[model samples]
Target: MEWLVSGLIFLHVTSGAVALVTFWLPLLLPKGKQAHRVTGRVFAISMIVCGVIAMVLASFHLTSPQWVEGAADTRLQLGWMMLYLGLLATVLVLFGLKTVRNKGRHHLYKTTWILFLHGALALLAAWVFWLGWSQRELLLIGVAFIAFLMVPGNLRFILRKPVAAPGKLRREWLYQHFTSMIGAGIAGYSAFLSFGAAMYMPTHAFNPYLWTIPTILGVSFMMWLSKRQPRYD
Candidate 1:
């Protein structure tokens, strides 16, 4: 079992590294070019692999709650975090790719992979928050709150009538792709920092501030890039 866990960790980290590196190439290269498409596909596939591994590992930890690396409780906490992060990463990448392939057609009302996962994660997030509250783990509570906030948008999806964005250009999908891919980038960076950089910076390594820095910077950059890009309408 331990060996299996180790192997999964290796695959998860390796794929995450590949995702982190390849994701940048698409961002830097000219859009609509072969290089961009190749790199973007590579990034999406690697991230999917990474996310799957993470979810598997999280399941293991949640079931067993025992680890060679940390206390059982700590392992469980990390497991929950990984589960949420992995879910977000996979959902974002898949949706981004689907949006591109759909030729700007996005329907929120109909059942979709993302909507299904989003609903599942919303429940998971509440459970996580309750667990954190019981244990008085502030970091877990904060993480759960962040995760919970990701779901309210689904209300818009289910409650409001499905309507494609106005205008022939329909640039909404591009913005979705940008934000989703950037979101995956943030997850990859956070995982690297938490697991990889934490080794070198033992002190203050697990600080929530450190984990959130990538998200802050990524969102800011996404906003700036959105403004600079051409609009659909």
Candidate 2:
């Protein structure tokens, strides 16, 4: 079991590194170009791989003897956090991809599975918030709020119909795609930075200010990008 966990960690880290690098390429390259498409696909796949591995690792953590013994430790906290983040990343990336694929047909994107995913994440966010408050762990509290921030906008996008105006639907889908992808990037950066700090700078691992850096930078960039009308071709 230990060996299996170690192997999963290796794959998770490897795929996460690939995701981190490829995430920038699509944004930097000319949009709708073959290079951008290929790199974007790579980024999406890598993120999915990382997220799935994270959930599996979280399961291992949660089911460990310490947890079963009702021990409250960092490991247990991380298990919940990992589960939340993994699902969050997966949903954001898939949402972005689906928005692009179903552009101008918003109704088609509201499949049962997609709706279920959103609902599950929303419930998890609440549970995480409760856990954070009870444990007094600011990191988990903040992460829960981040998930909360996504829920309303996502629900709105999934349920609401686009206005009957020329180019409005296109713009809506375009913005949704960009927003979701950038949000996924934020999740990737947060996990990477947090893991790095925990491994190399343990003292700063739980620093409240350190955790906010990714959100701050990512949101600033996201806002800047939102102002521009990106070309699909």
Candidate 3:
């Protein structure tokens, strides 16, 4: 039973890791249409499964409740849940619209959504920590908000036009997208593996925030390193 459970957890995390790289590499690196299409399919299917499985397993675990309430706090808890759910639905709608409106640019839209997962996951971590009232929960607060910032960054640089200068363009579009995407892929793998280990380890609970600090610094460093002046004709 122990080994079997561990294996399932490993599968779930491994899938998400592959999905992360496949999904984001194109966005960050921008290889070409062919590579983009192949990875996109891989990422989407993998993540959906990962999320579904994790959600189910979470039911059996003794994690903290979603909310705690005093009289006035009841509405706040409801609002919090509603806000996250509503944003999730809205993101889906917008991405769907982007797919339709920019049919030729499907990768752009999809990557944006996946990138948003950083914020979504981080924010969720924060909430879990807060509700659990665990001292360790405090760790993820900054990381979660930073994930939100990535939403705009991807939108401006990725979903929109290439911002790099023509002359300074050492690497091509697909390459840059690939780096970030692959970096994300690697990051996902690292985080997922970490999570899986935590999940089954029985020692410390799977604190999603475990990866938070590293993620924050890593993202900032990479973004700075990767920035370029737009190539103007």
Give the Cα error of residue 187 in candidate 3, in Å: 7.3
lDDT of 1 at 20: 88
For model 1, residues 76-110, the per-residue Cα lDDT tens digits are: 77778788778878877876786688644445434
- For every candidate in turn, the CA RMSD to the true structure comes to 2.9, 2.7, 8.9
Q: Could you tell me which residue pairs clash in candidate 2? A: none
Best model per TM-score: 2
Question: Candidate 2 regions off by >4 Å?
Answer: 66-71, 166-169, 230-233
Whole-model lDDT per candidate = 0.74, 0.81, 0.44
**TM-score of predicted structure 2:** 0.91
lDDT of 2 at 175: 73
Q: Which regions in candidate 1 have their CA more than 4 angstroms from the true location?
A: 107-109, 129-138, 145-168, 197-205
Worst 10 residues of 3 by lDDT: 60-69
TM-scores for all candidates: the values are 0.84, 0.91, 0.46
Q: What's the candidate order when arranged by decreasing TM-score?
A: 2, 1, 3
> In model 3, which regions exceed 4 Å deviation?
1-14, 20-30, 62-126, 132-134, 151-187, 199-233
Give candidate 2's error at residue 39 in angstroms: 0.9
The residue-level lDDT of candidate 2 at 154 comes to 78
